[model samples]
Target: MKNEEKTKKRKAKRKLSTGLYKLAFFYAVLLLIIGFTLGVVYDSFISKGMEDEINKIIELSTTSEILYASGEEFCTIFPRTMKEIEEQTWKLGVMIDELESKNRIGEDLKLKYFDLQVRDFFLVKKASKECRINPLIIMYFYTNNLVECEECYEQGFELAIARNSLLEKVPIKIYAFEGKTSHSVVNYFKEKYNISSYPSLVFIYLEDGEERWLKEEGLINSNQILEKALTFQNASS
Candidate 1:
C-alpha cells in the first residue's frame, strides 16, 4: 500500500513540472513578440519625429523668395537661349496689357520703354568670352527702387555696354532689401543672422547636408560679388 502511494505522488510531481514548463515556454514567446512590437513602434515614432523637424527647418531657413527674384531678374537681364527671349517678350506683353486694362496709360508706355531697354541690353550679337558673371546684378539695378527709374535704366544700359569688358566669372547670389516690409526676404535673413545693411551679401555653403554662412561685407561692384562667390565655392569644396 505504501509503494502504491509513492508511485501516485511521483506521477503528480511530474505532471506539475510539465505544466509549469509549458506555461513558461508560452510566456517566453509572448514576451519576445511584445518586445519586438514595441521596438518597431518606438523606431517608427522616432523616425517620423526626425522628419518633421527636418521639414520645419527647411521651411524656416530656405531663401526661396530671394532665389525666385534672382531667377526672374536673371531671365530679365540675360537670356541664354531664344526660348527665354520669347518668354520675356510674352511677359512684357502681359505687363503692358495689365497696365492698359488698369487705365494706367503712362505706366503702359513706361513698360514699353522698359521692354525695349531690356531687349537692347540683352540682345548683344556677340557675347564677350569675358564678363561671364551672372546677369542678376543688372536685374537688381532695375528692380531696386533705391535708385530712380531713369538711373536704373542708365545703369542697365551701362552694364550692357560694359559686359564685354568685365571678366567672366561664376554667379554669386546676394540678397538685398526690397522695401521697408517686415516679412521681406531681406528681413528673414537679417533676423536670422542679425544683418544690418541695405545690400548685405550672405554667402551660404552647404556641406554634408548642413548650411554654413560666411562673414562678408556688402557688395556694390562685380568684383566684390565675384570674391564672395569664390569664397563660398572654396568653403564648400
Candidate 2:
C-alpha cells in the first residue's frame, strides 16, 4: 500500500506544474474570450448591415407612381429597379453564405429575410404583369425542423446550381421560404400549397399570356428544377 501510494504521488507530481497549468489555462481562456469577443463584434456588425439592407429593399417598393406610368420614359424605371433588385439579391446571398459558414443562419432573422424576398418577388411580378413582360419565378418551401427536413440543405445547394445555370440563359427570380414559419403570409402559402413535407416547390410564370402556378413536392435536384422551369416557361421540348 505504501509503494502504491508512492507511485500515485509520483504520477501526480509528473503532471504539469501548478504555475504552468494555470498559465496554460489562462491562455486557453484568453483565446476563448478573444474568439467570443470577435464573434460578438461580427454579429453586431452583420445584424446592423442586414437591417439597413432590408430597410432599403423595403423602401424600393414605394417607387413613385410616375415611374410605373404607361410611358416609355416612365417604364424604364422597371428594368432599372429590377436590376437593382438583382444586385441586392447577390449582396444578400453573400451575407447569407457568411452566416451559414459561421453556423449562424439564425431562425427569425433568416426567415424574415426570406419573407422580404417573397415580398420583392411579388413587386417584381406585379410590375412585370403591368409592363407585359414575362416573369419566371419559383417559390421554394422548406422547414428548419431538423426531424422533418433532412434534405433541405441539399435542396438549397441544388437550387443554387439551378439558379446559376438558368440565370446564364434567362431572367428568373427564385424565392425560398420557411413554409412552416409562424408568419401569416408564409403560413398561408404552406396551407395553400398543402405543404406536408420538406422541400416543396412552386413555379409561377406567364404562359400564353396567362399566369400559371404549379407545385411540386419532395426533394428535387437541379436538373429537375431546370427541366420543370424550362417546361413551365414553354421553352422545353
Best by lDDT: 2
Once superposed on the true structure, which residue ranges of model 1 sit more than 4 Å away at CA?
A: 1-176, 184-186, 207-209, 218-220
Candidate 2: pairs in clash: none
Q: What tens digits encode model 1's per-residue C-alpha lDDT throughout 1-237?
A: 999988888884433578889999999999999998997776556445534443442332223224334545433334343233323433443343344334433432433334343333333211111223222222221233444232433433333333333324433222222223333343454566655443344455544434566544333454554555555555444
| Model 2 stretches astray by more than 4 angstroms | 1-16, 64-66, 69-74, 97-108, 235-237
In terms of TM-score, which candidate is strongest? 2
Error of 1 at 25 (Å): 99
Clashes of 1: 3
Would you estimate the TM-scores of all the predictions? Answer: 0.30, 0.79
Steric clashes per prediction: 3, 0
